[model samples]
Target: MNGERTIYSILHILNGKKSSQTIQDIHIFQLTSLYQSFPMLSREQLEEVIQTLYKEKWLVQSLDNHYFINDTRKGELENLLKDNPLPNYLNGWKFHAITEPFWQRLSLFIQVASHLSGNSIRYIPVQRNPVTQLWLKETLHSIAIDRSNINKYLYKDLVKCLEEIEINPAILINRLTGLKKIGLTSDQAALEMKMDPSLYQLSFLAILHFMIERILSNKEDYSLLCYMIEDNKKNYTLTASTAKTYDLIQKGHNIEEIVHLRNLKQSTIEDHIIEVLLNVPAFPVHSLVSEEKMTRIKDSIEQSSSKSLKVIKQQLPDVSYFEIRVVMARYGDS
Candidate 1:
């Protein structure tokens, strides 16, 4: 039932196009973009869902290599979903998923709980699917056996927060570990609780957020947690233009090729490359800059009072802005 509802949500987004819109056929790329926003399904899973929908006559393919919602079923699904609206957190989750700091903090929370529980568990970064299960298991286990000050505080604080929010603390425990003491999927838990899956997801997120806030507030006392959650020493992010350019580059496009394909100026493409180089640590800096040129740029910046690009550009007048940008990208603060 949850899978069917997920499919309906996808259809709802697809069918949201204006009636007079010419882009009737939803392309695979468009669906992939939509998945980034919702992220409830992977591309492979989405393809499988699409196939199932096609079999059920809920979706149809066009000659243009695109898909569309079946007109007859569209209205009925839309009305049903309207009564049980999609969670407001659907889009917000996308940002949290992409933000490295958020996951780092969550991973620390799990690791701390595991250690305090005497589980000797190694911490791996939390992924979207199993976060709730991991949180509930480790937290409960810590509370049960460990009488450490931190564990006791965490247990008490979480209980107080849940109670204040008017959510049954036991429901989380029961939902995650059903009658057999095995975990249930979010969908199965939703069914057991007689709540909409979307609502359950939102509720879970709220609880998670409250716990996170409580932990973060006492970060000084929870120094290990704070250290673990800190962003990589050099925090950086790609701008929108750079992100597009980086995607093209990943697809094996050269600067000229990217400029041609994107219909952007060569200089603009170069600027985007610089942005990518500056922001992405694993980017092959050596590929773009020679050791000699990098040294020269670094030396020039160190000598200059101002770290401005224009200042550096004046020092290396013969160099193009693109080359100077590469130098700045390597040496400058993000």
Candidate 2:
């Protein structure tokens, strides 16, 4: 279904909840958080849809800044959702966008955080949202409130995170940590839980969402959780190709040498470099493109109406595509 209809369906679901049924107004932050899991809509696109709904009088904003479906239109929206339910699974890329790397990292981090007091496993840094460090520290402090009973607190938090899911929390914890006593892959866990792997993954994401919601609900301590989660998008890790390129670069290979070594075209290598630069903060862009060239490319890009590399290339023919991409990687958003 299209974004507008999907959003309407979500509003219907939320409003129909027994707890929220008595209070029709939904908090904007809560709505946005739930909506983020859906595919085919960026934050900007979602906001636009919301604005359109408000303009059409299908939804109204309260004095307290929460939103409510107009009583007159609520029946129509409910009927629409009844007629057409949102698809259970999004398209592959869209689904990956919503979950994947972030959820994967979070699953691993939770395993580490839960076992912190035991000191059975060492904490290894992984590419994660910067705010995760803050959350980790705060969570550790919460769990340490009573030092003698750290394991109790950890188990309590884990149970809370998995409360909504049907699987035994102990089994899920063992699977997550690959504990020697109950080592199991996700597929194995899914089988043991009598669920499909896809459904298991969704349940995992739901658990994460529950944890994040709990964190966000503690308003005074986690007031910035919303912004932190949004900004965490920037920390997406390197793709396979970019990671290979990064490895070669670390081994002191230049772009041309990398292309030769990896048997890839020069353009491909350049694309990999750009991807690495955009996603990997530690990537050394200065070594590949000089300050003087980056400035010229940035200027040309700003003056040009089109962001297409071909159009920008026409203006700066002397600059290679690699150089143009480097500059774009640095200043594209500007």
The most accurate candidate by TM-score is: 1
TM-score of each: 0.40, 0.38
| Residue pairs of candidate 1 with colliding backbone atoms | none
What stretches of model 2 exceed 4 Å from their correct place? 1-234
Error of 2 at 274 (Å): 1.0
Per lDDT, the best of the predicted structures is: 2
Tens-digit lDDT track of model 2 for 1-334? 1122235445443323222211111221123223334333354655677789889998777533346688899799989867643323222211223344435445544455445546566544443566656665665565325543544554555555456654345434546552223346767877887765645654554555544545445534432222223333342445667688889998999988998999999877876776665456677778978889888888897797655568788888889876876776756644
Q: What lDDT score goes with residue 111 in model 2?
A: 55
Instruction: List the pairs of residues colliding in candidate 2.
Output: none
